[model samples]
Target: MKKIAITIIKFIGFFLGWAILSSILPLSSSENQAIWRLWAEIMPLLAIIAFTFIFWLIEKKNIKLHLFDNPVKGIALGAITGIVWLAFPVLIMYIAKIIDFDGTNSIDLFPVWVLAAFLNVIMQELLVRGYLYQMLKQKHNIVVAAAVTTALFTALHGGAFEAGVIPVLNVLTMSLLMTVVLEYSGSIIAPVIMHFLWNGIGALVLDGVSLADDYPNMLIATFTGNEILSGGICKMEGSMIVLFINVILTALFMFLKNKQGTK
Candidate 1:
C-alpha cells in the first residue's frame, strides 16, 4: 500500500511541480510579438525540464545519458519512421481530395521556434518516458506503465477527457506509437526524434500541424471533404485516416517488440 501511494504521488506531483514553476516564471513586458511568443514557447518547456531533472537527480540518474541502445541506428530509424508514417496518411488525404495545398505563410521567429520545438520534444520524452516510466514499470508491467504515462501525455496535450472521442483516440494512439518506439529501441532517443520530426515536418507541410498559426509553414492547405476525413476543426489530427494509420503502426510495433523477445 505504501509503495502504491508513493508511486501515485510522484506521478501527480510531477505535474503539480511543473505547473507551479510555470506560474512563477517572470516575464518581461515586450511589444515584440516574436519575443513574447518565444517566451511563451520556452517557459513551459523550461519548467518541465527543470522539474524533471530534479527527479533524475533524486534518482541518481545522469541526464546526459542517451536512452537508445544504439544512438546512431535509433536516429536513423526514428527519422524514417516519423517521416514515412506521417507522409503516408498525408498522401492518402491528398489523393482522396481531403486536403488541398494553397500557399505559404511566414512567421517572425521560425528558426527559434524550431529549436524550441526540439527542446519541447526532448523534455516531454524525458518527463514521461524517462524515470516516470521506469518507476511505474517497477511497480507494474510495461503495458501498465506505458498506458499510465500515455494517459498523462494525452491529457497534457488537450486531447483526453475534454476533447471529442476522435481527438482523444488520436492522441492516445499516437502516444502509444511513441511508447512502442521507446520500448522497441530500448531508449527514449528514438521517440524524441520521432516526435520532433513528426511535429516539424507536419508543421511545415500542413496547415494545422504543431506550429500552425503562430509559426510559418511551407504550404497553406485547406480541408474540403467530410469532417472526419478532413479532421474538421481539429484538422488532420482528428481525421479518421490518421486514427487508422496510428492503429496499424501501433500493432506493427507491438509485433516487432514481441518478436525481439523483449518483455
Candidate 2:
C-alpha cells in the first residue's frame, strides 16, 4: 500500500510537471509550418533529453539499466510490438466502417509518413513506454502501473480531446495493450516504439480524417472534422472494427508472452 501510494504520488507529480511545461511553454502555432519548423520540430527532441534523466531518477538507479536479459532479442521484440500496435488499430478503424480510405496525405515540407513513423515509433516509445513505464512497473502492480502511466500519456494530450465513452474506452484499452507489450517483452523499449508510431500516424499522416470523422455517430470532440481532431472523446468505442483489432493484437501479444514465460 505504501509503495503504491508513493508510486501514485510520484506519477502524478511527473505528469503535472510535464503538462504544465507543455501547456505553458510557448509553442509554434499548429497552423504555421515555419513555426512548426522552429518549435514543434524540436520539442520531441527536448522531451527525449528531459526524460532521459527524469526517468533514470524515477527508477532511483544509475544511468545504465537493462530490463531485458538479451539486448538483441529485446530490440527485435520491441520492433515486433511496435508493428502490431500500429497495424491493428488502423485495420480496426478501417474494417469497422470508421474510416473510409487509407487516409494518407502528402505534406510539402517533410516526408510526413517517415517523420510521423519515426516520431511515433521512437520518440514516444523512449519516453513513455521506455522510461516512465519501466519506472512505474517496478513499484506497482502491472495493471496499476500501466493505467497510471497511460493516463499520463493520454492526459499529456491536454485532457481527453475526444468526447464520449468511446474515446475514453479506446485510451483505456490501448493503455492496457501497451502495458502488455512492455510486460511481455520485459522492457519498456518495445512498447514505447509502438506508442510513438501509433500516434505519429494518427496525428501527422492521417490529418484528423479517420473512420470517426465520417461516423461521428458516437464521438464527442469539440473540434471533430478539423485537420487535427482535438478536445473530445475519441471514437474507438462503438466501432466493432477497432474492438476486433484490439482483440486480435492483444491475443497475439499474450501468446508471445506465454511462449516466453514457458521458456
Candidate 3:
C-alpha cells in the first residue's frame, strides 16, 4: 500500500506540473504550436525517465530497464490495443447522442494534426501506462493496479474540462481498455503506437477536431451522403458501430485472458 501511495503521489505531481506548463504554453496558436508541442513531447519523457529511475532505485527491480525487450511485439500489441481501445469514444459520440458534431472543414490541418495527435499518444502512453502503470502494478494485482492508473489517466485529460465528470469517466473507460491491451501485449510500445494512430486517425483525420475541446469533435464540414453515418463525429468515431465493436472486442479479450490464465 505504501508503494501504491507513492506511485499515486508521483502521478499526481507529474499531472499537476504538466497542467501548469500547458496553461502557460502557447499550444493553441499556429505559430508557436510546434514549440509547445515539442515541450509536451519532452516533458512526459523526462518525467518517465525520472520517475522510472526513482522506482528502480527504491524497488531494486528496475522493471523499466526491460521496457524494450521485444520491440516487434510491442509495436504489434500497440496496433491491436489501439483498434480495440478506440471503440468506446467512437460509441458515445455516435450512439448516445451525447454531443453534436458540427462540421468545420479542417482538411488543411490534416498533416500537422495527425503528427501532433500521434506524438501526444506516444508520450502519454509512455508516461501513464509504460512508466506509471508498471510502478503501480508492482504494488497491486492487475485489476486494481489498472483501475488506479486508468483513473489517473482520465483525470489528467479531463482535469482541463469544465464538465469534469463526463470527460473523466470517458477517459477512465478508455484507460481500462488501454490497460487490458498493455497487459495482454506484455509491453507499452504497442499501446503507445496505437494511441498515436487512434488519435491521429480517429480524433483528427476522421473527426477533424481536437480532443481537448469540451467535447471537441469533428465539425460536419459537408455532408455527402448517408446522413445517418456520413458527416460529423460518426465519420471520426463511426457511430453506434464503434460501441458494439468495442463491446465485442473487450469481451473477446477477456475471454482470451481467462483462457490463457487457465492454460
Q: Per-prediction RMSD in angstroms?
A: 2.6, 6.7, 5.7
Could you give candidate 1's per-residue lDDT for residues 1-263 as a string of tens digits?
99878878887787788878878887648777556656776787788777777877865773333464788868887998988778888999999988898877766666766775676677778778876787777656787888899988887787434547887888889999998987788778889988988777787547656543565676788888788788887777878898999999889988998999855
> At residue 189, what lDDT does model 3 achieve?
67
Q: Write the per-residue lDDT of candidate 2 for residues 1-263, one digit (tens) a residue.
A: 88768766766666556555555556666774533543543565466657566867756764343444455656777667656655665564455444544333345545543453454345455556655666665654556656766776666544345454545555656666776766676665666556655544444454422321211111222232321223223433333344456566777878988897899
The C-alpha local distance difference test score for the whole of candidate 2 amounts to 0.54
How big is the RMSD of model 1?
2.6
Model 1: runs farther than 4 Å from truth?
28-30, 60-69, 159-163, 210-213
Q: Which candidate is the best by lDDT?
A: 1
Clashing pairs in 1: 67-187, 103-220
Estimate the TM-score of every prediction.
0.89, 0.66, 0.67
- Kindly give the number of clashing pairs for every candidate: 2, 16, 8
Q: How do these models rank on lDDT, best leading?
A: 1, 3, 2
TM-score for predicted model 1 compared with the true structure:
0.89
Error of 2 at 128 (Å): 3.3
The lDDT values for all models are 0.78, 0.54, 0.57
Which has the better lDDT: candidate 2, or candidate 3? 3
lDDT of 3 at 164: 34
